[model samples]
Target: MQRKLSKATTLLFAVTAGQASAALFEVDPGPYDPAIGSFAAWYQDTHGRTLDLCLSKNVSSRVAGAPGAPSYMCSLLPEPGVFDDAEPLVFPTNFPPEAFWFTADAAIADAASGIDLTFGAAIEAAFAVEEPAEGDQISFARIRIRVDVPTIGTYTVTHPYGVEVFDVTAAEFGADGGRAINMTRDIGIGAPKTYNGALGGDIGPFLRSVNGPYAEVNPATGQLDRFIGDPNLDEPVTGSPFDTNYVRIQGPGGIDLRTNLFAISGKLSEVVRPTPVIVQRATYSRSSGEAGLSTQQDVFAMAPPPPATAQYLDSAAATVPMTEANATGNWYGQSSANATPPATVEVSADNSVAIPNSTPTTLSAPLVDVVSIQRAEYSLNSGQLTLVASSSDETEPPALTATASSGAAIGTLGGDGATKTLVTGISPTPPAKVTVTSASGGSDTEEVVLLP
Candidate 1:
């Protein structure tokens, strides 16, 4: 239903510092339909301030408080402490594949200074589009605004995703970071999230792996590993062994409520288990020779490849309904098979601590050898030990281990060591040469100076 703008409710955001508890405001979130969707809000400040706003057509499925669904969250200013107990409004659950539109209007009855409504300013707005969400036609745009006043002097208002208030301090809106989204009648929605589903676009495949409705690109390689379905299933499987990105969905295996902050990935392939490994054995009866004609018997086919590994990437709430192309806007088109998956990002006390140390301080030098020169992986001369590190993307952090040259015992390094300390043998006075191996087999080394 369309709610027109009203004056009394407009100035809700303009409450005076001391007693604006009754300040009114409006907001509407939706599990939008392809048709028409929008939300409108208004409020009047006790100080006689007016406000009006609307969010429609652009937003992710509400995580909690949403129309048609139960309240998921509230949108109070600054810290959410005040609105913690506040409840959100609900819209009709059955929107019949329509869009969402909201309109808000408020009137100001008071102000801190003697103000005149005369020579009032015209409405102002700002918008921009992100390459990640921008499709052949559609652009993931965000809107921001600032108005000059006789009192507040240039007040600013912005809504990037249209649903959530943005922390607009960032420069170039990166993934998860809000960017400008431009919309026009000529623009079209980006590719219907590349993956397909029974619901015209089943989020089941992606939701099955996501912490929320969004998906992040693989930081390690920017490519993706395979999974069963989307994590946003209408009903998640219980006891599921699935990795929890940020939160868990329960259904099949068991109900384990958990979450993760990693990227979501994987090719959603159907597993027809209980199908059977058929072994057509030939009973060589004397008749075997009778007709050399059809003596061919089929043996059990190679076990269908062990189900593919699971992988996932994190996505922006605005990036709901991901496309075949990387929503993070990296190349590879969000394709899983690409070799340069985005590398995993890990910030450390030292961003320059790139090279790894020996796995075990043994008799030999390298306990583990990071093979890549780019540092995706490295080999450590753990004296008698060696670490066999399986590397992923090189840009982020590299995994390492040190095992004995005997191939029997192993040692830990850096974090902890069971056999021997990775750096135990390095001299405290002089630095040693440490090398890191890249996925491509290149090598780079660093000299870590030890101190007494």
Candidate 2:
């Protein structure tokens, strides 16, 4: 199924002026490049991390062809980290569990076997941990060079993932029909060469020690030899040039493929979130029962100021627990029973309070007349206060309205005309005031203090 696509192979990226005809090709050069995306700027933007390898050596070689044919050259640079063993290769553990290692291998297969080797530097070989084929791991890590042909805008070399080359035999190379691979080319300095399958010309085998017995060669003849029941060293080939191996391409006219430039990045940990604040029912209970028929009773409740200190206006008038009293006509009034439950009281705990951090403060008592302030609620968000003015005798309850001091605004009155709401922007520092007025012209003023 693996066939070297023709140079006319369409590029994955659109062809720009003086750019390579193809964008990505396949090749199995060796272990997954530890420094993946080292030269890819786009890689950094997408993966959020950079490759681990560093560039060691970069050199340019010019190939002169027959007069007027075409002048071209490419750079011979090793893949990042190929040369420096001091820095061990480390794969990212952050990758998805199912992520597999991918690489590109270089080779020229049987030219006469209907397989094409014309795609100058496209991917030729690869191995994946999850690859279905159970092939030898030895041939998986082969070192190939980079071939950057500037003129035609093509760099024939290995990339991470792509289609695999067709399988064939070493017999094609005059050896036993062993494992087949797509051979990578070299950036020759002393001597120059062109690509011809094992049939007639030099079919470049990976020069670096990483690839052993895989299209292995006779160093003496530089010709590819077959696997003679011998396996490559358990480890990659060692030493200097080995350390600097890079991805390379072999164009027919001797053009070089330049490695593209790019970067890598990653996150350390997750962010922590904050907790929410909750307002609970007011802390209060009925203290005394209303006197039978027409007498008032003392209302008592603990105002549990929030730890953060708060300014609140509380009243027990409209909220006093009420009961039906027996008479010529049953009348609704404050409960005679002392154990009646009280309604919730709201408190506004504005942060701008004048009291010292450790000081505990309480609001002033309301102006008491015929009607008494029964229950009060304060809204923390709006700094609004609602007070209930109540009378012991429901039939004669006073009609009440509220007035505010400086920086305060009055809201609606209750249906019974005994409850009033006041809004204020005054800081708790100076304390705000509200006066409750009865329809009969009687009035009482109360001081609102915010606690710390």
Q: Compose the digit string of candidate 1's lDDT tens values, residues 239-264.
A: 11121212221111232222222221
**Model 2 TM-score?**
0.17
Q: Tens digits of per-residue lDDT for model 2 on 316-362?
A: 43343312121101112222222122222323332113112222323
For candidate 1, the lDDT comes to: 0.20
Ten residues in sequence with the least summed lDDT for candidate 2: 41-50
Report clashes for each candidate as comma-separated counts.
150, 63
Work out the TM-score per prediction: 0.17, 0.17
Off by over 4 Å in 1: 1-205, 209-233, 237-242, 245-452
